[model samples]
Target chain A: MDTDSPAGRARGPYAKSAERRRQIVDEAYRMFSTRGYQASSLREIAGAAGISLSNLQHHFASKEELLLAVLERRDETPAAETAAADTAENADENAAVPFDAAMVARAAANERIPGLIALYSVLSAEGVTDGHPGREFFLRRYDSLRAGYTAEFEEVRRQGRLRSGVDPAMAAASVVALWEGIQLQWLYAPDRIHAADALRAYLDLVIVSADDEGADA
Target chain B: MDTDSPAGRARGPYAKSAERRRQIVDEAYRMFSTRGYQASSLREIAGAAGISLSNLQHHFASKEELLLAVLERRDETPAAETAAADTAENADENAAVPFDAAMVARAAANERIPGLIALYSVLSAEGVTDGHPGREFFLRRYDSLRAGYTAEFEEVRRQGRLRSGVDPAMAAASVVALWEGIQLQWLYAPDRIHAADALRAYLDLVIVSADDEGADA
Candidate 1:
């Protein structure tokens, strides 16, 4: 572990390489947000990151891989990281908060980062194409989101928090849809459509307050 | 107006040219749906339509213009045409159906044409970026949709069809968002998420049926 040792000397370039890779992903994320995936060429991203395309490719073999890295980078952010952790913990029934509440918090966090939200809005929709690189990433992301939201809604239903006769699965799908749709609308008119407000509004419609629940259900 | 007359002869080329333009838009629509706006090149689209690049340019002038054409083409379809007509007629209170009900019919129509839905899903989301050609179109579209749905929901409120305490504007926005979100989900998992069913489910939460209205109110 000594800094002067041969292994430590070898670690220098590897560490620098990792840093360089991170820099590339950072540039790609910015470009993907501003210029979009189609317009942001690898050369442009590499140039912006102060590296050559060949060097960038040494880190990410293709644009698709680079796109995934950018997406994963967003996913690795603190809020998203916590959400992932909570998902794993939910199986043990030890999650600190329900999935829908976590999503509301995430949406609030997203408001501070319009660029990332725009990137997600554009890519997730574009990824619906048959051969787009982001296709599988989106498909899996949505599947996971729908399943998580559904489970959370089901839990609320069990507790009699869900409105009478509201289907958890359908509500899950609608919430997922609303988030995606609202964010895109927010991008257009940020002053009007707040993601947190929209989510809360829909949640209120489908969820009963504890006081109201006794009379309703 | 005789077919053999000079003016009539001139009309033939204009008619053919319009048909050729239609051909380009149709081809662009197919490509935009299957390959996406970013991935579908002008050359490839032109090649697919059996026209030269310059010829395509003569018709569309730019990819953005071509994109607008494709989007407008979809908008000019019967369902959209009727919606526009109804919107105009709505001012006189002569509109046969409410906007939300019209949307339900539109969603059902959308199910039959997955390609158009994919095109819309990809473009509307992608259009959120600063300079996307579809940006103006979608912005106008959403603004109009939100206004129309809000008006209809207000009407529902007047009749005691809307759930008590629900905000008409918020519900309008959520429904619009849900449609966009659900369609993308449907693209990924066609069998699992039906557009009409999802819209109806959300509507059921906010809008009471005739028999239930008296009981609820």
Candidate 2:
């Protein structure tokens, strides 16, 4: 009984299971965001998702597992987009790179994904302690992102796009830090600030291109 | 019944009380840093401090109160130092301000403060929801910090020290965010990163001086 079988398509148990998981995750995210992880209860999550406690447990095993799944799903969105951008950027590495303001603008415009951003920030801070599953995940996530940005910086440096004495690894770390930091603040007071504008301003200060000669040295 | 009377001065109740409070905070910090607020218990904290539960409650009214006091005390250290630096820097506002490379270097050299930093990171994330005492504290702290940095940035801008079109408020927010973000990464892998150096590099790129005119525009 494959869920996608043509005969079982209308009465597919797998499809229902998948939909139930999505519904649970969506409810959990809302509850966690509004009530926080400690204060939110599994019963409430189940109630909000319109499922029985047994049904919820059948899908998720435990509250922690459910929370992890929610986080994983949220993280996948940006990871996929960033990966695609990296691949495209890598393909054009040999060519005289045309300034891609549109691509940067698109990433910047993703400021609307505040819930997912907030989820990551909250989970990351919570994950710093030992034995937290997300601890390893966050550590590896940052390492890979830092490595990717550092490699991009090095590539630009090799092409003579960077100024002398500028350390690419350090700069990449700082940029990532700035992005995460602003996201934290934005989570607290979304109405008072624009994370996208803040990020763009930071990028403008650090990243230099052949087209822009007189940027920050 | 003065505890510091000549005979009791050597080991007085008052002195003992003060010592006990310090011991409690130190142990609380350690426990909170490792186990987090929700996971850590008062009995455990008292046990760690080598005190009775009653004595621990005598020092701090409640677990929440103790956590607040511990956090407040921790925040005071950096605020005091920053205030002193602000006063000294403001005194020479007209002069060619010397950058405090040593201060940054000292921060970079020290890796022991990651626990304190991680505690704040975790609490701040949890504080986003309503009813968390730390929510008001962090919100006010950020507001005041942003105001101070904004004023400083405005003064520097008036003196023609920074690039044009840069918003002081946004820049200040970004700076705070970057600082917190770097702290998060450092907490995860203290052995692998120099957060202070990363911060300094980013600051160097963002901040320009009147006397230095090397492609800042």
DockQ of each: 0.69, 0.56
Instruction: Give the alpha carbon lDDT tens digit for every residue of B126-173 in model 2.
Output: 667546667876787677767877776676677776665677788778
Candidate 2 is graded, for docking, as medium
Instruction: Flag regions of model 1 displaced more than 4 Å.
Output: A1-10, A80-99, A210-217, B1-10, B80-94, B209-217
Q: Against the true chain A, what TM-score does chain A of candidate 2 give? A: 0.76
lDDT against the true structure, each candidate:
0.77, 0.68
- Residue A2, candidate 1: alpha-carbon lDDT: 42
Worst 10 residues of 1 chain B by lDDT: B82-91
Q: Which segments of model 2 are wrong by more than 4 Å?
A: A1-11, A35-44, A47-54, A75-110, A158-164, A209-217, B1-13, B50-55, B75-103, B158-160, B214-217
Estimated TM-score for each candidate: 0.88, 0.78
For every candidate in turn, the CA RMSD to the true structure comes to 4.0, 5.2
